[model samples]
Target: MPLRSVIKTQNNQRRSFGRDRSGATAVEFAMVAAPLFMLIFAIVETFVISAAGILLDTAVDDVAREVFTGQIQQADIKEAVFREKICGKVDFLLTCDKLKLDLRTIPAFADIPTDVPMKLKRVDDSSFCFDPGAANAITVLRAYYEWPWTASFLHKLAADTDGNSVMFSIAAFMNEPFGDRLNSNANCS
Candidate 1:
């Protein structure tokens, strides 16, 4: 072909290509798919984590009420039983094995510890203990769980070495004077 005709043909093809809108929507959607999916996953994961935390807090509050009312006495329920009860109540998104419980009596309400543990794995850790105090005594109950991140890209959200974040709930109250004050040596598992 002649040079002028070849150049004109090339320009026509370029214009045709530029004007074609056939797959434009698909291309635009493809470009945004990854980021859109990531945002959705982040929102969903945050919601589920928040819900699990709320469930855990509700369970702790309910169980602590039992202790406050002398329904969960050292003489009646074992530590394992108490733990099972809490786990049962939080069965929606949390596993029982990952749950940790610490129930103990404080010298006074003002003596309640204000620190959260830097490392937590099991209920047997030094930071965890089981001791239901006597009637009218001040007590604090705490629960913890390690929430694993499902998305690899969200690893930065994890706070623990195992690539998971910690969820915790606490309840503090003075036990209602119901049971014998002497029956306070409760063991927690």
Candidate 2:
């Protein structure tokens, strides 16, 4: 073959190889980067949600402790006790009126009523009599918190997919911290 023809064939081969390699970097990038991005985003979202849940749980336990110890009175039900103790302590996580605290004294596990009121009342004042044998009676404090999602995208996802409200309930139980001691004659209705 002539030298000119040989050189032209070599140049043609090089041009074909260059065209084939053109998109190789982009394919490699797509393969590696897609899953890595997803994994990173998932981890960040999980951490945010878990932190919010822990904060809400802590707030519930705090409020329940106060209710069981008789530190909160009927007058202080929603406004004073809940506002100051629970909602105030949680940083922008919960609101006072948005929370519902229900304290029930269960004389017997069977006596625990299903229709529990959504208020904090003195268990002693209720017509429900306390049984001494049931001193191990259960005091159920239910804390309902409406947790707003920190991420707008997550909020929309929850609403659209699960139809679950942004609210969650955390219940803390302690044996009636006070068996039968009625501290104040003040009506805890």
Candidate 3:
């Protein structure tokens, strides 16, 4: 109970506490957990986005055939019908309402526009131009969707920052000689 003995005991207790390894597991976990969880979430998000991209590409490939073969034009398939077909072919997770499509047919392949549009820059759907030109013309089809996300970082990484990532698919091909598309008043507009 001397002052010197009390000081020595306090120093020894402090040193012991500093060297103690009892909480090492929690400390190590804390150091590793943040990065580990981030990596896991990133991987999951990457997988999902990749899957969506594949699905979109597959749907475009399937639907583009109808356009190339003039089936869509011959049937006079309305714009809504074409959209409905595309939606039916896509995954259930994709909201059909969010799908935006742009289909353009040019006189020749050389005349094809070189822009890769992903989202609707303008809000007016009526303002869009759709020209599924005559038979043997080159047609380009583009579709866009905003996939919702719960992960903040992934959303910020996306071109759109509202916790939504823009997913798009494109297809270009020459219309087969099924019939003269110019003669048919395809209601693609």
Candidate 4:
């Protein structure tokens, strides 16, 4: 072929390739698929975690009212009863065995400890406490739960060594002076 003819053929092929739209949609989707999926998963993870936290907070508040009014303290087994009450409220989305509770008397509102760590991978008796305190005493109740993530990439959000994120809820209030909390009938209803 002559050189001029060869050059014209190459130009025509280039124009045809540029005008082809058959694979454009596939290419565009491929380019955006990864980041798009990641964003969607992140949003879902955030929503689920937020919802779980809210549930935990509400459960803690509701159950803590029992202690504030001296109902829990009147129970024969204060710790066990308190745990069961809290678990009943939050068991829909969270495992009951994985729940941890800490209830103790605080000298004053300012004395409430804020530095409690969540690094414990396994929830156990040593991981928390239960001290409902006497009537008219100030107390703080805290609950901790380790929530597992469906997406492995979300492990980085975990505070526990087991690669699960921690959810926390707290309630602090004074006992209502219900009178003779310990000697009263077990009215932990």
Q: lDDT per prediction?
A: 0.81, 0.53, 0.74, 0.79
Order of all candidates by lDDT, from best down to worst? 1, 4, 3, 2
Number of the candidate with higher TM-score, 3 or 4: 4
- In model 4, where is the ten-residue run with the lowest total lDDT? 180-189
Predicted candidate 4 versus true structure: per-residue lDDT over 163-185, tens digit per residue? 77778888999999988756232
lDDT of 2 at 34: 76
Clashes by residue pair, model 3: none
- The runs of at least 3 residues in candidate 3 whose Cα sits more than 4 Å from the true structure, single-residue gaps closed, are 1-21, 117-127, 159-163, 181-189
For candidate 1, give the lDDT of residue 66.
87
TM-score of 2: 0.51
Deviating ranges (above 4 Å) for candidate 4: 1-21, 118-127, 157-162, 183-189
Q: Write the per-residue lDDT of candidate 3 for residues 13-114, one digit (tens) a residue.
A: 999988887998789999999989988998997888788878888898988998888778777766777788889987575778888887877666777555
lDDT of 1 by residue, 1-189 (tens): 899999999999999998988998789999999999999998899899999999999999999998898888745766788898899999878999889788988887888876567645322346677777778889999887878888777766464446777788999999998958443447633
Q: Candidate 1 has which clashing residue pairs, if any?
A: none
Model 1 ranges off by over 4 Å = 1-22, 120-124, 159-161, 181-185
